[model samples]
Target: MALTGAASAPPRLAPGGVVTRADALLAALRAAAPDPARLPRDAGALLGERAALAGLRRNGRIAAGGRARLLCAADGWIAVQLARPDDVALLPAWLEVDPARFEGDPWPALAAAVRDRAAVPLVARARWMGLPAAAAGGGSAEGGAPGMDAKPPLAEARRAGDAPPSAAEARPADGAPPRVEAPPALRVTQAGTPRRRHAGPWRVLDLSSLWAGPLATHLLAGLGARVAKVESTARPDGARRGPAAFFDLLQAGKESVALDFRAPAGREQLRRLVAWADLVVESARPRALAQLGLDAEALLAEHPGLSWLSITGYGRPEPGGGWVAFGDDAAVAGGLVARDDDGAPLFCGDAIADPLAGLHAAWAALGALRAGGGRLLDVSLAGVAAEAAAGGVDPRACVVADAGGARVLCAGRSARVAEPRARRPAGRARDLGADTTALLREARA
Candidate 1:
């Protein structure tokens, strides 16, 4: 693997094909096992997992629509998500338009507002106002036309003059890039000694939502683990609100249980469920579920073989410590966005971070299980996205449009992201709480 953005060098990106981080993960998994090839390349197979579930991939590739499209600004470009009802409701304030009158697509009205504004300030305002928006750039705060096929000054300049700095001297002003030790991604503690537990059929308690955590457990389900997905009734998994098939796409086969932990009975039920599991997966922020009394430390203390997988945006520390993030924003934070000719960034794939983290999380979980499941694996969405982007597997093609004389914009074209060529496994997405009765019975039993 090539180290990108070397001293005085640009990150060398390969021409697009399948977007896969499987090699690194497979190699890592192999380090923990004698045979790793038995692990299904779901990362490769489940490439279009979302689209295939939504029946969107049957036609070909399809970009997001409505408020999800990339829009322009006077200075550069930004992606704004007004897909939520609340998000759409706030459009009147952002664009100074009447939300009541605004129907149909909201992009045009928002675009009208962004027409003459710089992206950074607008994106800042959007964030301040609690909207999902990200500015387009090659992960740069200072936006400028990108140097065609050349390294940026940060990579090219050594000190004041002379040649580019050596890798050691190329450290940023903040010293070496931080190693992300604040809240920590993965933490392990010995619970006595590694118990030589015989492995047979396994049970999993999936307390995760959206893509990453669910994907991990889903892969585990395929590997002979009986997974019971637990969601809170007060705050159900949002994926349930998405296209029915899409929700099922990633969550099929797992038993589903929804409970309100506020209730004493509900809390007891959750405790029993946790005790019944060989593994647990969740995407909650640090101390989130612990606030609800499901302290992972205490649970692991009780069941040393129970592995806890905790997923987050950044790690659990400052910056993105407690801050919320979805796949796209987190991917952008990890510098996975496609850079246009002027270095303006574009959204790459279908929330690219989710699946990559999913793949890595599953691999990590299995590796931990083999080594003795007595740890909390901190899976950061941004870190996983950075890992995937760093693989240099992002092959981009220029999206061309037939204009008057075949004209193009700064990027000279839009970005066409590549999906890994793999067949999706056969399954059906389940309805919310569909398996509640049987799972609850099994837990009680």
Candidate 2:
């Protein structure tokens, strides 16, 4: 929501929580819908339809700038002109959310929501629904809705085709505030400028697949670290062939190398990389890394200062029975996702939970690397989901309007998946706090 420096991070929801953009867009669409309560039960399905509706309304007036028209709806749904019927047909899947979680200080509550939601997985059903601004309306060429664009200044930073401006150009002259395009998919900053070489034993091996693991390495690469992205031909990263925007966006500023770790040579290459690397990031489930014979303990044995970052759908085993299964995005919605009582999931509409955790993992790796300890990070998507929702999944907390013409309310201001009061027996109390006590007593009487 606030931008201080030249680089402004996008809003991030707790690991399983909705990205701010997704929330903003969904809220706008809900507010504008003929009947806000008629959205679909599934968040993904509703978003698909809403995007389709926006396309139909525009009717081919779609332009590089037309995306801004969508954001303007945040103030109130307004008429959006499309350039062509095809443009209108294209539905936006990306939903904007609160930016503070991503750029500013990390909110533990949001992070927890992301963790809890990782148990349920969802397919990447749509491309990022970008709302580029309309130039004619005094909006920059950056991809943002009129007033509610993701990062209006960041949108202004790019020249064309989504490339970031040169480092020199990124900084504004005359002491004026720097103008940026949408928050960059890749933010590359060396620890120090070229003239001042950064101090360290530096090497990072990225043995990760999908957006989470690889994205972490990509962030490091942008920051002047040489990242070796190792993917086996047998188990390639899914994003290698994802949407054009995503693939280009995710893979930028990095080197791509393939290796089949199952093979003897692959294992040898991996070891060599590990021996040379200061850090390694993997997205496989717990102990899955050991199958590849890349256990954290063994890695530390080989490289005393190796930072092993492991990302999983769920948390590492704890004393309690908190073990849960999580998928990419869908799981988060199913678990911690905001929904209405009628049973409609409020889709965050972005691959938010996974990536935010990845970013945090990168930060953790950096921290461990700085501390000079061979660190082991278990990034739990489910934990992140729970953190996002502030430690609970209450269906009555907020009303989410969807495309299918439905509205779902999560009960109470706070609801914990670990203990759902709504499921308790009538005239009985589960975990009702003081506020809920009176209501429960009144209902019982």
Candidate 3:
């Protein structure tokens, strides 16, 4: 058996909350399903969306602590994500959908059918683009997992480093007339296709090196998008060696294009791809993209509907914005490093912030697209690490020290708790004192 997606299935019910995959899936399936009066066209859209949602939700609550809603097209290709900033684990699964299946205008009935087939329950009233109620199993109403959350079509058709598309292909989804006016900033464009709409597949220009940045486009690849992972031969991706760990994990469904963006021609070629991209994601430091001539303003002027994401250690224009730093786990442990009285530093065991922040960038990009809103996503590793510790106390504050001893720190606090044995009781000492007194008197005589 394929071990139905749940690992140690969460309890059917939890207190201070109502979380049950079965119920949420079932409810979403029922609500999003089209009625003759509502959806009018194909019901299959709803079904497919529901099925994909069930699969994405199956992983249950991830360590970052949030649930995700999967948007699917009839062909089993997931189109978008409705995950919150905290739900980072959903990216991999989201990236797995085929691009050929995206529907810019999704069918309500089809989404419902998919839900029914997957046996996923739904929580009612989830709506997007005037669509019916829908819900991913664990999302809550207000935000975060255990609540309400909001939430790809692909076309391959292209390998990495393909020549960029013409100006027409780079237009935004705003339906505005093309403008000939030039802007002071970099020249750019954006494009966004809605669910259930039969739009041609697109290529992604990925200007990220490591796990967090490239991971977004890697996901885009899984859904049938052609992701050209842009790298520089001068600065190779860290994943190329680090256990070759993230290379496969992040680039699973994508192709790579190593380019020297620092060179003049590289910028022109990149602009061609930018003109061709429906979306662009970067893990560069703040203003770094602009230096390379790929900032949001430049891109949006040419392609207004384009969705852009900027994943970073801190944030652009914020304190420490451009300062390069470690991923979430490393930064957190380093920031909170608790030195023993001996002055030795200790760190946490997980590298959590990178992936969590990466996933948030991915989810936000998709959400903005679905809503037809183009904006820059400023995701920070430190911010995400802080979120992981939410609702919990700081460990350092309550730490207890041990008493001085030969015991190794491994013994923990036992050195402090132990007390030395007391001297013999007064009664036993009295006899010894009397003997001493008699000896003294004899000597005197």
Candidate 4:
């Protein structure tokens, strides 16, 4: 009954002309499910990239609009994310200028500074400081150098005090090379022995944020998993600051555990909680998790049946892991960006990567869970976007129109999708730290 009455309803969004491949995605999930009946029939009902984005907007959109956008640097374009207050505070360091120079808004000064600087060094430095910044048009940030086909994984997050892997020594091991030099659409790696457990209740630790990861955990909740959303007191999920309804829509049935992730006690609690989990859902790059001592390999080895799903903007474990990206940029990375008549890229429907990745992650998790354990699913947003795009919009499902020299596509009959109701169990959502004490005791016990 984890999610029986937990899900109320998603706000109705006027169909955006842009169509989502929701049907294809859902079909793929259903096909992959080892036990289809274990999944809610309406799994696709609450899905749609645009609908998810609409849930996050304020009045009409985010008050902090353009917090993550492509900025014009002196030599090229760079994507900088100033989503959190800490990120805002790091701008002065990123720009190497006075924080008060912008008065209150950092946009103008940031624009000027970025305009006067080159993208590469600015991106590298921003990442070195643990701030979200990346080069646009396939430029590299922390993980790999510019123009590389795949992002190489960094052994550790290249924060201000950390060291990045040396280019000379970061070579593929001697023997057979990777199957693909470029990121693969889907990659599944597992270790240890598989042990299947069919039970009435399962435990999941959700360490991801934003749409995709949250949506995956949400689906698991509907599937009868007892999901505990693990957040850091220092930086809770950004969704909390967005409209409440949207937050509730995806998080209604999950418990919240806000711990000081960096502190000794918090870290101890995290270890216990993770050890107690049947599955761990996270969207961090491998290095980020390494920094927190949650080594996937070690964890899988320690807990033979533990299934860990690592979500990234690109693939993980090397050549793609360390790279930086977000939902929109990852979709663009996947080549779904709308283009003008001149073939210039235009923004597509609401951060499409988020929802697509979410669905894919949920399906992957279910498969891993069904397989029993010792499964590590590395899901990349860009890779998923590429996977969805590889299917392409069915020509029969769309129509093209030309406007002022710009070409656009509109959804047709094939795009008219529906969300049918299912008998999901009733459940409740918890507030920040609502179950910390009880969970800590359980973990310890």
Candidate lDDT scores, in order, read 0.56, 0.38, 0.36, 0.60
Prediction-by-prediction clash tally? 6, 94, 61, 12
TM-score of 4: 0.70
Name model 3 segments beyond 4 Å from true: 1-198, 328-346, 393-445
**Candidate 1 lDDT tens digits, 194-229:** 443445667778999877788778777666667889
Which one is best on TM-score? 4
Candidate 1 Cα errors over 4 Å, as ranges: 1-20, 23-45, 55-78, 89-105, 109-131, 135-199, 241-246, 287-291, 391-425, 429-431, 434-438, 441-445
Relative to the unseen true structure, what is the C-alpha lDDT of residue 323 in candidate 1, on a scale of 0 to 100?
41
Per-residue lDDT of candidate 4, residues 109-155 (tens digit): 87777675655556556655666654444321111112324542232
Clashing pairs in 1: 8-155, 16-395, 137-345, 185-378, 248-429, 317-321
Over 4 Å off in model 2, which ranges? 1-201, 318-334, 341-344, 391-445
Q: Which candidate is the best by lDDT?
A: 4
Tens digits of lDDT, candidate 2, 1-445: 1000011122111212343423443344344344544321222322222223222121111111122121111111111222223333432221123444334322232233222221101011111121111111111212111221233223233322343232123122342211211111222222221121125535677777655676566556545566556667576665554443444444554545566667987676666666666777776654556667776656665556566777765444321012222222212322333222222222232333454555556666656665664566667654444344333332233323344422334433432211001111112111112222332232234
Model 1 whole-model lDDT (C-alpha atoms)? 0.56
Cα miss at 313, model 4 (Å)?
2.4
